[model samples]
Target: MESSLATSQMSDEIVCFCGQSSVTRTSLTANNPGQRFRSCSFYGQPDAWDYFSWVDPPPHPRYKAIINKLLRKDNSKRNDEQQLRRLVKCYQIALEVFLLGVIIQKIWL
Candidate 1:
């Protein structure tokens, strides 16, 4: 229950003033991470409709802080996982090189 975003319902039946269908999308900005919103599907196109609405109510200050903290923790874990994978790969290559050297020494002796 870190966030209520998962339980929030997004409106897919929204329509823009210009008669265009609205698309539901989640926000990834620092200030509004994980928040969902609906906007015109044709937004930003030339001569297209522009509209926006939040699916979830504005988060309280406490909720915002909690969400941001969780996001930082998740990102750190991801970075650590990637670094570990790289380290393992380097070790594998070194082991292969060492085994090749040992084989060459045996053949020469």
Candidate 2:
């Protein structure tokens, strides 16, 4: 199974004072799901300073639900559009083949 944590190369701008880029993860709790943040590489070490930063604020539950719903709808629409395009291409090919057969019959006669 894939972990939910996202890995990124730490840049100079976001490096911890300890000179190491911290790993980033999203909160998966019921109250703070999808909240992104970064932590120091030496997090939890007795010698390391506490380092944490939020990359994005947690949205209201209602807002999150609405966003998820809209995303699902958008994905469904895209899949429908792709299926329609494939159907249209198949129809076009079939029409061309039929027309060619008709012309060949006329030529033989």
Candidate 2 per-residue lDDT, tens place, 1-109, comes to 1112233355344666666666687765545556787877666677774677788888788967766676678789999999999999999999999999999999999
**Runs of candidate 1 exceeding 4 Å displacement:** 1-23, 39-52
Worst 10 residues of 2 by lDDT: 1-10
The lDDT values for all models are 0.74, 0.72
C-alpha RMSD values across all candidates: 8.9, 9.3
| TM-score attained by model 1 | 0.63
lDDT of 2 at 4: 23
In candidate 1, position 4 carries an lDDT of 12
For candidate 1, write residues 84-106 as lDDT tens digits. Answer: 99999999999999999999999
Model 2 residue 89 CA deviation (Å) reads 0.9
* TM-scores for candidates 1 onward, in order: 0.63, 0.51
